[model samples]
Target: MINRRIMMTSLAAGLIAPAFRSAFAQEWKAKYPELIFAIIPEENASGTVERYTPFCAYLSREIGTKVTLRVVQDYAALIEGQKSEQIHVGWYGPASYARAYLTGAKITPFVIEVSSGGIKGYYSVFYVKKDSPYQSVADLKGKNLGLVDPNSTSGNNVPRFVLDKMGIDPDKYFNKVVYTGSHENAVLAVQQGTVDVAANWWNSDDDSNLTRMAKKGMVNKDDFRIIYKSDIIVNSPIAYLDSLPEDLKAKIKQAFLEAATKDKDAYAKLSDGKDDPFQPVDHSAYEPVVNLVKFIDGLRKKNG
Candidate 1:
């Protein structure tokens, strides 16, 4: 069974009233007692569990259903799970969701993460230790570079696109390019000087992985410096399986919107306090990402 018990700190009290659950919430209780809400394993499974438990709980209470929080092993697990209807609602990365939607997964995006500044997107950033002499992406030539994961939008896809746009092939531009697996790890590698520079996401107007780590007391923002930033990339989106009953999907979307509006702080947590509240979106919002995926795919095919 997918785990429902996720460890997280308590959220603010009285933000969501139990009275707000729709009256029809009980109608499907017998048919679907528990709904599975899965996350793409952007970070370590343990960290995903810790951060998203409260998020899932808030949705559970708002929707008046038991929402089980599950973190799949990788992007493929999540996309396949949604395609198979094993996952109900998914907190998916933009590129992954686009791939899932294009491949005929019955998935529909309804809400996108907004940062504290009312921006619905973020930037892919390349950073180095504060003391490093590098001042630009060109300067990183013949030096180590770190990336998050292959499926990571801000970490890999967008960064690759940005580099190519700058006439740099990551494959040959850097002395060494390493997939560090997670944003936190990429940031950590830069802080620890394991890599000369690493790519990660930052709030377009606010904080980023480094700030998030600082918020956790893991590292200070002053320890690293961002030398290059890609254009705004849409933040990850929350998508629900289209196979779900229409009413259930509506309720799920409404529940999440309400929770995000009332508990904006918790909402901010999703995007490192760069977004405020949440906003509705559709598959079209991610078309650029789909195209980027295609471009990246073309690059890979050419390389082979």
Candidate 2:
């Protein structure tokens, strides 16, 4: 009787083990047939969607699976999505990527954008109207200031980091501060004389804010003056959630690395026509930004 009982127990355990492994696979693997690719709203939502639609379609074809482009509310939303495994892929700003890493998000970046001039990074440029009397950041004392979102690399972190190093505290230096929400709006504020100075991103000879604005006849390059520029902060990154199946992540990364050169038209739209290629990058590229975030946090605490 004891021998028969042991044989029955062994048979039952074998039967249940396969079902348990199948259930575990279902939990660990992707739930949907289509991958959700999220874009943090560096600009307006409509523009972001329009720019990435082609890239997403190409990615879908390259990966043999459908990929959807989603424009998140802001940097915070993308971070949360990655944390929850809702965003399988992400395109994030330097500071945002650093923040995600600090906050324990599961995303890992694989590519960093390089501009047309082969510039590996961009600067946080502080600008004022050409006719403005402000000759330097020091001259902007007691004047209104416009800044993009706090999560912004070029728009906020770089400016703050640079200013702190120069011994200028923006909170006390400026009479009023305006969070313009986007680089376009921040630059517009300066052009319209709403603020004495504004911070925006810049890369020499690239189709950045003012140059693109010039092409649209919105703002002339001569109309604005760059008063201050931060050191070359690293370019933006494209990342994937670590929760993805290893094989799927490999396919997506391979697809993105080729998307730029293979489809110039689509890549141009994604790059604002700079034709920058997506180059492989690791988490180490953003170490400086991580320290910047910490530095900015210390300043904020000091001020408050």
In order of appearance, the predictions have TM-scores of: 0.85, 0.87
Quote the lDDT for 236 in model 1. 85
What is the Cα-based lDDT of residue 296 in candidate 1? 90
lDDT per residue (tens digit) for residues 1-304 in model 2:
9999999999999999999766755554456478899986545677678888998888888877789988887788888999998888888889989889999998899988898767778888899999888899888889999998888898888888888888888888899889898788888898888998999888874467778667657678898888887778889998998878776777788888898777777888876777567788999989988998888888888898
Model 1 lDDT, residue 292, Cα: 90
Tens digits of per-residue lDDT for model 1 on 57-141? Answer: 7878877789999877767788899899888888877888877876789888999887765778888888898888889987888
TM-score of 1: 0.85
TM-score of 2: 0.87
Off by over 4 Å in 1: 1-27, 41-47, 262-274
- Alpha carbon deviation, residue 2, candidate 2 (Å): 40
Q: lDDT scores for all predictions?
A: 0.80, 0.83
